[model samples]
Structure formats: C-alpha cells, structure tokens
Target: MLKVQEIRELIKLIDQSSIDEFTYESDGTTVSMKKSNTAPQVVREAVINTPVQTTDTKLVKPEPVIEARKEVDMEKENQKTEQENTSISSYDHEIVSPMVGTFYSSPTPESDPFVSIGSNVQKDTIVCIVEAMKLFNEIEAEVSGEIVEILVDNGELVEYGQPLFRVKTK
Candidate 1:
C-alpha cells in the first residue's frame, strides 16, 4: 500500500501531468485520483486477506475548502436529479419509486389503493407507499394526470427508477 506522503506526491505529480485522472491497483491495494478545480482528491483502499479498508482524503486539506467541496458535490447531485426528471417527463407521466423497496398499493392490507387506473391525480397526490428499510415512504405523483396503468403490484419488490404507475398527462 502506498504511504500517505507517497499518495500526496502522486497527487502533486498528477496535478502537474497532462492527465486528468490516475488509478493504480495491485495485490489488494487500490488508489484513484481525479483532478478538480480546487485540487485532486485521492481514494485509497486495501482488500488484502483481511477485511477491506478504505479512505478518501484530500492532499491539500482545509476546513472551509471541504465545506465548499461538499456544496459543489450537492450541486452535481441536484443537476443529475434534474436530468433524470427530464427523462421521466418524456413518459406520459410516471409515478416511480424513489428508492429500492417493496411496493404497497394501499395504506393498510384491507384499504383501497390510493389511486387506480382511470383515477385522476395531481402533484402532491399520494399514489402509493414504498417500504424501504423498515420505513414506509409515501410516493407522490409529481405531475397532474390520470392514471392510465398500474405498473407494479402491492407487496411486490420494486427497484430504483422502476415505474409504478403510468399516467396520461392532464
């Protein structure tokens, strides 16, 4: 495994090199580096006979810089989410799982479903519940529409990005 100083030196080298990223792996040791506007961030991991150990650290670290980096990371995440929403908008409209979990059509076993085919719905309408990791999350219809189809069944396992209902836009 590379020492901390060695990794730091590599970051400096990469920052000076023409490459934008660098990676190395051998004998259960792995190192990855990527250049950003601020500085290069390096992630190191060891997966030897023992359990895996991982660490991600900045060579030129500062408290305010870390906070700024987090904000930038969050902005990237928000942009990615916006792109995904754009893709979903291409559909007539879809009520989808926000996470991987079991789909529940109703609040209780004997209760009627929140929405059915032909049911008119609007943004903020609770279309269903997704039980993820012991948490029952109310899934909402973010767009106004009429439910054209139910894509998933109650108590069925649903994956992230899976469409639970198809809607005809209002």
Candidate 2:
C-alpha cells in the first residue's frame, strides 16, 4: 500500500516539474506518470540567395530572411504507430513482470489459471498475480494479444521485466 504522504509528495512533484512523464520502481511497486502536451506558438520565415555579379563589382543586396517553422504531421504519427503495432505482432512479444515476487497463476490456490497458452487478452486483463511483502498485486497485460508461451511456472519467483509470457499481438 502507498503511504498518503508519499502519494501527496508525488503529486506535488508532478505539479512542479516540466517533465511530462516519470517512472519509478521500488520494493516491488512500479509507478508511471504522464502529462499531456501543450500547443506551441508557430512562427514562419523566408530565405533569399544572393549572387555576386562580378569580382570587380561589389553589390549590396537586401536578402529576405525567412524563419523556418516545423509543422507537426498527425498522419505521419498515426502511420508510425500503425507500423509499430504491425511489427509487434510479427513475432512473439514478451509480457514483462513488473516486480520481484512469487508469481501465481491465479488469484488464489485451487483456482483455474488466470491465463494459459493461446489466451486472448485485453490491456487490463490480469495475466498473473505477484505477491510481495504479503500484498497481492495483479500483473496486467499492457498490450492486447494472444498468449504464445508461458515463461514462468506457477509459484515461481519472478524478477522485474522477466518474461512471464510471450504474446502474439493482435
């Protein structure tokens, strides 16, 4: 469980820092924070090339200086995201365990496993359970995919970022 004061301090840092994202891991807990982007003021300018007429003739030309402004393309960003998703599905992707703990196949003993090979899953689906410091933490899927393989057995010790399962992204 997170202490109230610690949580409050985290919120204060978020309010103070210019960073839009932060991630921290300690004592079997992982916390990720993100903030949205703000629009920037755009300025544009022009450029002119000056040529020397002759070596003997010194000519003074007023050149038009244009400031170049970068435009953000939404379509390109979307296409990149689509390409990333396509690549992720081409091979089995690792479902990383977030903490060091005793991994459980189910929330409790004598229950059917939370997931198995070839299980289809959404982002929020609980793939396994990890017990740390007597606290049960549900390990969730970050990607929507089908389980391709199980890397760890039930009751196995799992380290952070260890491959708990290999998934085939949809």
Candidate 1 per-residue C-alpha lDDT over 50-137 given as tens digits, one digit per residue, 9 for 90 to 100: 3333475434322211111111343576799997677566448777789999999999999999999888898999999999999999
- Error (Å) of candidate 2 at residue 88 is 11
Over the stretch 11-31, how does candidate 2's per-residue lDDT look in tens digits?
457646787776665554445
lDDT of candidate 2 vs native?
0.72
Full-model lDDT for every candidate? 0.78, 0.72
Candidates' TM-scores? 0.47, 0.47
**Residue 122 lDDT (model 2):** 93
Clashes of 2: 3
